[model samples]
Target: MGPSTSAPRPRSCGAPSAGVMIPHKTKRGEAALARLKTYEGVPPPYDKTKRLVIPDALKVLRLQPGHKYCLLGELSKEVGWNYHDTIRELEEKRKEKAKVAYERRKQLAKLRLKAEATAEEKLGSQLDILTPIKY
Candidate 1:
C-alpha cells in the first residue's frame, strides 16, 4: 500500500512546530475578536429628572415596621433600640419559618418515595406473570 496522504493536524496548545507553520493571531487581534463575539444591547440612558419620595413611604407602601427594615433596609426610627430589636426578631422568625418548611418538604418526599417503592414491589410480580414470554 502507498503512503497515506492526510492533512497535517494543528497542535492542541502552545507554539506550533516547524512542520506546521500556522499563522497565529496576536494578543490584540485575539482580544478584538473576543470583544466582537460578546455583543451587549445598549440600555436606555437613566432619567435624572426622576425623584423618589422617602418620607411616609412605609405607610404608602402598606408594609409593616419589620418589613421596612427587612425589604427596604430602612429603619423605623433614625436611632433607637426598638428598631434594632424589631429587625433582629423579624429576621430570626423568617429563618425559623424557612427551616421548618424545608424539613416538612424533606419528610413528605421520604414518605412519598417509600409509598411508591411498596406499590412497585406489589405490582412487579403480578405484571411479570400476566405478560407471556415469547421464545
Candidate 2:
C-alpha cells in the first residue's frame, strides 16, 4: 500500500503557548470564529471619550492590560475591524460571565445551607408510638 500524504491541521494560532493550558476549542468556539470572520466590515463613527467602537474579532482576542495609546477602536480601523462586532462580543462575554457567577452563587448557597443543618435535622424528627400488649 502507498503511504498516505496529507497536510497536518493547523493549531489555533492566538492561544497561549505556556502558562495555563486552555484546550483548543473544537465546536462551541465555532460561533466566535464565525463572528471573527464576519467582523471585516466597517463600524460607525464613535466618540473617543465615551464609546470606543472596535470590530468583533479584535474584541474577542484577549487584550493587554493598559496603555497610554489612543482609543483601540480607531486603531482597529487600520487593522480592518469595526464596532458593531465589538459590541456583539462584549454582550456575549457579559452574559456568559453573569451566568457563571449566578450558578456559582447558587452552588455555594446550597452547600452552606446543607452544612448548617444538624444530623438529626437532616434526618428529620423522631416520633414515639405507644403499643398496648394483651396478656
Candidate 3:
C-alpha cells in the first residue's frame, strides 16, 4: 500500500492556545478578552484583598518528576513575549507598594503620638482645676 498523505492530527485540541493567538471578532468576545487581559499589579479595589490559590493548578503540584512540560510563560517568551521585563515591572510595583505602606504607617504613628499628647494635656488641666489652690 502507498504511504498515507493525510496531515497528522494534533494530540490535544482545545481553546486555550487559540484564545491567546486569535483576536476576538465579536464585540462581546472583545469585551471579554479585554476583561481577561493581565494587569501590571493588583487593581486598586483588589490590592488589599486576599487572592485565591488553587492547589491543583500550581505547577509544582501538577508537574510530575522527570516529566517534560513547558510553562505557559515560557511558551509565550518563545513566541517573542518579553517575560523578564514583565517580571521586573511587577517587582518594581511590589517595592513601590511596600514603600507607600511603610510611609503610611509612619505617618499614622506620628498622628497617634500627637493625639496621646493632647489627651495627656487635657487630663493634666482637668486635674489642676480639681486640685485645691493653697496660695
Candidate 4:
C-alpha cells in the first residue's frame, strides 16, 4: 500500500466542563453568577447594540503551531446536544412568521382595491341620476 491519505484528527481534551467559568470566591459572587441567565440567540433588547468580540477567544489567535483543536460547539455535539436540529427548528419558525405576515399584507391589499372600486361605482351612479337626459 502507498502513503495514508486520511486527514489527522483533533486530540481529545477529556470531559467537558459545565457552567460559566467565572471566578467566584465569596458566597455573594457565587449567587450573582447563579442568578445570571444565559440566552441562546441575541435578545430583542440587544438586537440594535453592537456585538463584542474577545480577541483571545478568536480561532486564529488561540491556535498553536502544528496543533489541531476542536471548537466548543463540536464538543457540545459529541456530548449529545443537537445544535443543527435546534438551528433548523428556529429557521422554520422564522420562515413561518414571514409567510404569515406576507399573507396578511396580501389580504389587506385585496380589501383596499375592492373598497376603491365600490366607491367609484357609487359616484358614477349618483352623477347619472343628477344629469337630465336630452330627448
Error in Å for residue 58 of model 3: 2.6
At residue 73, candidate 4 shows an lDDT of 47
Please report, in order, the local distance difference test score of every candidate based on alpha carbons: 0.47, 0.45, 0.62, 0.59
Best-to-worst lDDT order = 3, 4, 1, 2
In the range 4-116, model 2's lDDT, one tens digit per residue, is 63322112222222212332374645444544421222233321123355675473454556744454444444544444366657657666766787799899999888775
TM-score for every candidate vs. truth?
0.35, 0.29, 0.37, 0.38
**Candidate 4 clashes between residue pairs 3 or more apart in a chain or in different chains:** none
Best by lDDT: 3
Q: Residue by residue across 1-135, what tens digits does model 4's lDDT show? A: 135533221122222122235556678767766666544433456543545799988877878878977665456456554554675566577667667877998999999999978877887867576558523
The worst-scoring run of ten residues by lDDT in candidate 1 lies at 38-47
Better of 2 and 4 by TM-score: 4
- Candidate 2: list runs displaced more than 4 Å: 1-81, 119-135
User: How many Å off is the CA of 108 in candidate 3?
Assistant: 11
RMSD (CA, angstroms), candidate 4 = 14.5
- On TM-score, who's better, 1 or 2? 1
Question: Which clashing pairs does model 3 show?
Answer: none
Model 4 regions lying over 4 Å from their true place: 1-20, 88-135
lDDT of 1: 0.47
Model 4 TM-score on a 0 to 1 scale? 0.38
